[model samples]
Target chain A: MQIPSPYDMIAIGGSAGSLPVLAELLEQLPVSIDCTMMIIVHRLKNVPSDLDRLLSLKAPITEPEDKQPVLSRRIYLAPQNYHLLIETDGTFALDYSEPLHYSRPSIDVSFASVAAAYGPRALGILLSGASKDGAAGMQQIIAAGGTGIVQDPASALFDTMPLAALELCPEAQPMSITDMVHFLTELKMSAEHDQ
Target chain B: MIKEISNEELETLVSLIHRQYGYDFSDYARSSLKRRFQRFMGYAYIGGVNELSDRLLQDATFFERMAQFITVNVTEMFRDPLFYKTLKDLVLPRLATYPTIKIWHAGCATGEEVFSMIILLQEAGLLERCRIYATDLNAVSLLKAEKALIPLKCMKDYTQNYLQAGGMEDFSSYYTADDEHAVIHSALRRNIVFFQHNLVTDQVFNEFQLICCRNVFIYFNRQLQDRVLRLFYDSLAPLGYLALGLKESMMFSEESIRFEAVSAVHKIFRRKS
Candidate 1:
């Protein structure tokens, strides 16, 4: 067995039309992929969020409970109106402070925190969104020497987010939804091979 | 995936926090607690959980910093404006009937909510009769709360929230601002006491007519949530009110039977006689 890659935390942030892309991406991944995934999507507060349930159809997913330990192969969604952060120990930290850019679960807050917690071990992906919220966070991830990925603006339903991210991380690999799925599978396979 | 903090290391750290500091975080949501421990380790520049434990043993200042981290301290004035609006429209009228009003702001970080409550009571003509005990486990936050100064950058956002929450006067009237910070008017600070109190370790100090414990319980595990809810239940006067964060609820708690929702939409409840 090949040694497992240190990159295990996959932090994804998106809004607007990112759901379909997420659904598709998860559907393509093998169920036994040895990584922990966390997704932060703009969501409505007070009303119970069903994003976790909706996405779990494609993969095992849950809204992380306060301080819950992050589990491999399980997908975690930022709870409605909470910013999802990672502690250095790789457990989930949900923050209920004022919404950033009028968004709870602000992509910047989560991305920056994850970069700080995981540094080079983090893999951050920016997806479609109407706003430029995730750009600075993507910069933080790349600055920390973590890999940064962006959805190709041409393929995004809303290109504003990806364009903004590209401005900060010119080196960020832009992938189409289908290509992104293949990339994730290859990365997983490589990690497994190393183990 | 990265290996999680070993259970034995986690237990030793929590035990140290409990034994040395007397703050019982053992019942806090374990996953969140572990996450916080990890963040604390990173912040302290330690490489491992065991190293963090050793540092805690060697350094007293680390405990003080840990107190700040262990209790999450993000808050804003009039958060969830609709909840405040609900209080103004439906709850304040009932509070006005009392000759003297006492409120407890559990986990009152940096005191923004405390000031927001004062503003509402002042506008309702109830400020003169109201006394609020705002408490938190973090002394540094309590000190900041006592100072009544917040970054002026947030005032714009807070102003909008104040208006949406149904402010009767100009929001600017509540504070004086300079280039970097805004200091709440001294008038609103009257009858408000900022103190260090631990929800997990402290006993009920007073029976309150209103308890505004918002957004704090979501950080706790279910067991701790139940224990804290029961404490609030025991500390409330008959027919008193309890205002929770819009996302928090007592429905799943053992004390749920003791109170009825004042406005279920806003998570406000009134103790049933």
Candidate 2:
């Protein structure tokens, strides 16, 4: 099912074995689409996560600075060891709050903030992961009248996160990478036409 | 996720707080304030935003209870180790030239960073010549910081941070530990004077060669940040150093502000005379 409004903000959660799928989604993003996108992947606290550098082959990605503005047509990676919160003023706030589900940059925390900041215009996508961190965040998005998309559990390498999100938001049917890309492009086109 | 207060209710609550208690939270970042409001509601077992506001309006003591959540933020001994390392390498050497040094640590919540700074000073052989003033708005936090204690379990990580910051000696030697806590050695606590000062409502109290108010600005909006930056500027001695968190900036305020970034990467600035 297609969400009616063009997504003003999008948050994607990934962990375990979701890197390749995340890369594909970012790579296939329509160039004309203009919105803020955040990528949250479960990473170790002290470890060097150059996820942005790895994913920046075609899509230029940045690890946002504290209280940095959330500009359109740019992608952000959740900085390591900091819970990334998007404030309502289209800026980011990073804090060292306690880890949720043993993950410092918990997807749930960001997703909840997105739900609060964007309400119905927020879009959340849950991909492969080994933990249940993003499930409640997806629930929060759905509860706030936002659209949630789950990676097909059958296709996920680690299906735990996708299945967990599906349990909370059954209306968010499993979507394959190609199908998700097609749907996003169509939404971008619709929004552009309306303008 | 808990329900957040509406923007209107949030504004009313902030205004009510300022009017009743004279603690100005009017300029705090609304996003962080909203998050704290949700936490307060959960703590008080109040369901709706109106109910929470009503309870605070009725009970004087409840606002005191709410202050604890608003203040008393988190800190570790050596957050962002590289920032500390830069302090040792670049900042401290110039500070040693003085026969006596005065340093002010604003928003020194629980004094972890104060302890960290003291350790650095002690290593540089400048502790004897230095007088450090550490202040926070929360009385309970000031009392805790005066005790010079930390959780014993956090020592391992802090030790790693110390080593990365080019620690000259063993970090374990600074504290004595039981099963639950590690009390810092009394010798290391000699130079610091901890007190209570509010960044929002307080004015400049003393001039210092170095002033640090790190990571505290993230809780404030741009206007409040500018106000606090001006306070720090007035509190600094001419050509004094002002250190901030990695991403915090002074560029948000007026155009002719008199400080120049000496090390933008480390968030260290110097007053231009």
DockQ leader: 2
Question: Which tens-of-lDDT digit does each residue in A1-195 have in candidate 2?
Answer: 222347778889999988999888887785466678899999865323467788998698888876678886678999777778888888888766467888968999899889988888889999999998899888988888999999999898999999988987787868988888887788777867766
Q: Residue B77 CA error for candidate 1 (Å)?
A: 0.6
Off by over 4 Å in 2: A1-5, A46-49, A185-195, B255-257
lDDT tens per residue, model 1, B110-137: 9999999999999999999999999998
How well is each residue in B47-118 modelled by candidate 2, as lDDT tens digits? 998888788889988888888876636788887778888888888999998888999999888899999999
Residue A96, model 1, lDDT: 77
Candidates, DockQ: 0.16, 0.41
Docking quality of model 1: it rates as incorrect
lDDT of candidate 2 at residue B127, scale 0 to 100: 93
For model 1, what is the error of residue B133's alpha carbon versus the real structure, in angstroms, after optimal superposition? Answer: 1.0
